[model samples]
Target: MRTSSGAGELLVELNRDSGVPLHQQLESGIRTRIRAGLLRAETVMPSTRALAQNLGLSRGVVVEAYQQLVAEGYLVSRAGGKTQVADIAVVEPTIAAPAASGPPRIDFRYSRPDVSEFPRAAWLRSVRRVLNETPYRSLAYIDGRGTIELRTALSDYLNRVRGTAARPENMLICNGFAQGSRLLLQVLAAQGRTRLAVEDPSDNDLRDVAQAAGLEVVGVPMLETGIDVAALEQSGADVVLVTAAHQFPTGAVASAETRAALVAWATARDGLVIEDDYDAEYRYDREPIGAMQGLAPDRVAYAGTASKTLAPGLRLGWLILPSWLVEPMAQAKLMDDRGSPVFDQLAFADFVARGEFDRHLRRMRPRYRILRDTLVDRLAARIPELEPVGVSAGLHVMTWLPPDLGEDALREAALQRGLGVYGLAPYWVAGDGPAGLVFGYGSLRRKEVVEGIDLLADAIATIRG
Candidate 1:
């Protein structure tokens, strides 16, 4: 019999002496292969004549086998005289039973915005406008920093909204905040700056980024106001990363006094400040705070991203660097990815220029504010002991748990009741802090937010009892 080993070939052995009919044996073999997932859906089967010739059988036997499998729904006959496996539903193998079951139904993870509210219509219009207006030359490999049009638009926007000292020549568009941070760290390492200081209780992923670049990461203590500028100065690091507007997880705004102290510290030590202006657009109580880069533009490298305002999947972020670091940062970006995609940058520029971006933010801020208020109100009314702190700004609020309860235990209990609550233990890099939970209200609706907090309170009560 003609036999060949290939990805699509099926191996079959038929015995004329056996009591089983040739057609029945072929069908059984094909059925077993399908059930075992060896033959996947839509995989083409060898033609009847070819299979019969290869197996030294009559064409009628092969045809009968094929017709039987077709009737059983394991195979399908397609147009243009082709036979292929049908889209049959197969039972997957259950590897093992889980000890604790699946994840919670309601998630309260931090730093995520309401993606369902993304402005699809406005974005599509902007994309079409950019594609129509863009020159052919702009599509080729050009500036490593980004399209000049996008940089100019960002310059105007940052200056007007955040009070930043931005210039098109000094801005570089990056993949996201993570990539931008990596590029900055690489540039600093090149300059023989080996130490990087970050705010304690900050995002662990950011500290890992610095460590990945072979730089020593030191944690500076966070105060009630913001990062303790006094401790940061003593850290003796050449570069420090700060979230001045709304600190992650804590939602603490850096005070004017603290901002001035940080700027002066950078000036005195000739150190560099990397300002991550993440989520500064979603302030509820008062006017949003301006960027710290306005105070000392030459020393601070201001970074912003569309992850909070739009979506994280876009991977769009920018850095407004000091005049001296422009070439170095751009060079690092060149070696990293040869700059971010140009089309998205152009589309974002069009979106900002047409005022669609600001309009979207205006529409979203009130909804987020109401959600924030609802979360705080529901938690306070349901569980008086679980006090919600940092309620004025950002997408999340930190609540201090009771001194008697452990944060991890409470989180696990909440998860069991289909409620996801995050503990603050992972945020701290050093010494222990009070037990707390972080609730992100951005993705949860008003009713869901209320119900979630009630369930969380019930979980805590059961744990205490």
Candidate 2:
């Protein structure tokens, strides 16, 4: 029953006495041969009945194992042809390769926007209207501080929606939050404020951006309510960057008491608070949190972005500056990139002014609420060891892994199972503290989220075992 030495022939030996079940033994033997260069591409294996006869096992046992390998894309069969081993050359395992290539099979990573839900029809209509109605001068290199019409529209919108004291004149449109932070840090540093305070476990990219702009970043402890006020005072930082509406990664809303206290501290020290109101609109729990910039506009350099609301590829964001800093920030804008795309900004202005933007948000909020609940429910059902954090709002959840599963080991095992997960240790300043995973459900479908988390549970179980 064994093949002597044909170029396309393979030898799959099944051991019934290894204590491993016959089917599992066949599966492991085939996979190990594939990995060890024993089973080359285009090689054909003996038929299930032939192999079973050769190994003195029932035909059903060999067939069951062969079926599994085929289901996993490792083998192929034809109507009247031999079941050949699939081209193993093309099947480089996902975990064996670099992490940044394509989308992960089961991505538990964070900060993803659901592009499938963007208002395509409304947005296209706004773009067409902007080309028709906007004055020719508005399209030219006009105001370095962005278009006035857009700012005016935003003035009303922010006031109505977020309760921010936004004036058209005080707002400066820039590339996005990153640009706003870079310009603001440069301005503050020019005014002799080189050291700034940031949340301890804040976004690592934010920290990288701040440092890249030559500003020294100081760590301030972040609590469930907000940044620790006492810790802020002790850090001796003159400028503070905060995500007040909902803290990034953690999803903590700043408490009213802490907000007032922070304002008081800033006012006392003649300091400034840079508020990054990112992803505040998609609150699943209560009404949208009011902008912290509203409490004391002059003391708060409020930065807002459309990366989450609309799309990140748009690369559009705006900042409402304090009056005294408007011209300076505008000049900084001119120095930075000469301002964002004029047409896109005009189109966005028309989009927001025509009330299409708000409508899109309203439509998406319910869908996201369902997705969030599905993620929670699935993880709860499959992975009881995984505790879902940041359940209140935002596009993702940060689930803390239990202590038994070390973050590094679990991450590797997940990658092997074609799952993507971002560990929390990288975001911490200490770099060796509490570890967890950031699961982004925005771009994922409801069914995918459920299956993905279930797969994740299996991977974790394998690692634990």
Candidate 3:
């Protein structure tokens, strides 16, 4: 039915014979009107009695619908006053015009998994099992260290897969690696540890995390082997963050010598190391390297996430802190939103325990390796001049551009040609570095990877001209 109010025109259609309840139908219709901006802010709604009488329904039905709308913040009700649409911001609908442009047809941005490969059936089954079997006590406010069940599962999993010596008591589940890093920084800041040293050409977002927590961020130049341990020691910074297994963007695995030197540096300086073991599972070449945390568990605080393995939306990550930092980090976690959602933690534990996680990885590793190989092969065939720097491991590979080509110009040209490519300039904290591009193949299919590289070669040619 359609009705004109003092504020504006409100149209609501009701199907009496439909299986949907009348109140819910009414609620949905009104909500749609509000969202569509047909009903503007402070628009007065029709009186429930009048609406019910006009629709030939009981006054109670209209009242219930209006109450629901009010509760959902779509409508506001004052004390014994008329109900009106809430002052909510609504996006204006786009007009039916010619399509201007869209995002790149193929994206090479890093750190995202192929979401199409997510094990939906297995995850759903795990969620169902967790819901069915969990005790009522598991539903309440639990430890900020996360459920012991998940921590224990993670400890065992890490020990087996990544060679990290973790115990349930020393592990803390976090929202994600981002949150885990922030919590560690918070605890460090509390202890008056003000300076944080990060890999020079590292992920900028992580550097910002330490800076946001009031720590002075220093950049240690990345060497061919790994982060420059000698430069790090010379910089006099006590706390260092390293992506040891597969360095981001550069993909430089720290050599055994560098690893030993880093451990010695930490031990001698009485310092701590934050190990970001991100995306260490999908190695295409040799077997994946064990985490640096295994070398010196007392000095390293290891962080890992399911962002690359399952999906970033899961927001599930864990931290394995040294004995000294465990209590402080736990207290920081407690103050930072209590803890990650308990249901997800429990469900993930069940997923790991049932071997679904490992099976999923085993299935995905080969697929990802194929995609990576396809990317490498196509890039070599099409753009032989660009040296692919980091192709051994991780989701992405770094391609060093010809000295004549500017990274910014090439990236812009590639984008114009419907090829999404990221430049390496943003990853540097020292303000300058080698010009290159980071190409991630995790989310791209084989054909898409080939087509994207072809387009990229064309873009590079266009830029050179």
TM-score for each of the candidates = 0.83, 0.77, 0.82
* Candidate 3 Cα misplacement greater than 4 A, ranges: 1-100
lDDT, model 3, position 58: 90
Off by over 4 Å in 1: 1-85, 88-100
Write the number of the candidate with greater lDDT, choosing between 1 and 3: 3
lDDT of each: 0.87, 0.82, 0.88
lDDT of 3 by residue, 1-465 (tens): 323374423468999899999989989998987899888777678888888877777989999999998888998886576888887734456689767877788999888799899999999999999889999998888888999999999999999999999999999999999899988998888888878999989999977788888899999998889999999998878899999888987989999999999999999998999999998887878777899999999999999999999999999999999999989888888888988888899999999999999999999989988988898888889998876777777788998887888888888888888888998899889768888899988998999999999998898788777
Against the true structure, candidate 1 has what lDDT?
0.87
For residue 318, model 3's alpha carbon misses the true position, in angstroms, by: 0.4
Number of the top-ranking candidate, with lDDT as the measure: 3
lDDT of 1 by residue, 1-465 (tens): 222234335687677789999999999888888788767777778988888878888999989999999998998899988888887723344578886777677888887899999999999998998889899999998687998988999999999999999999999999989999998898888888889988877878878778888899988888888999989878888898899898877878899999998899989999999999989988888887899998999999999999999999999999999998999888888888887898899999999988888999999999999999998888879987777777887899998777788987888888888888898888887648667888987888898898898998888789879
lDDT of 2: 0.82
* Candidate achieving higher TM-score, 1 or 3: 1
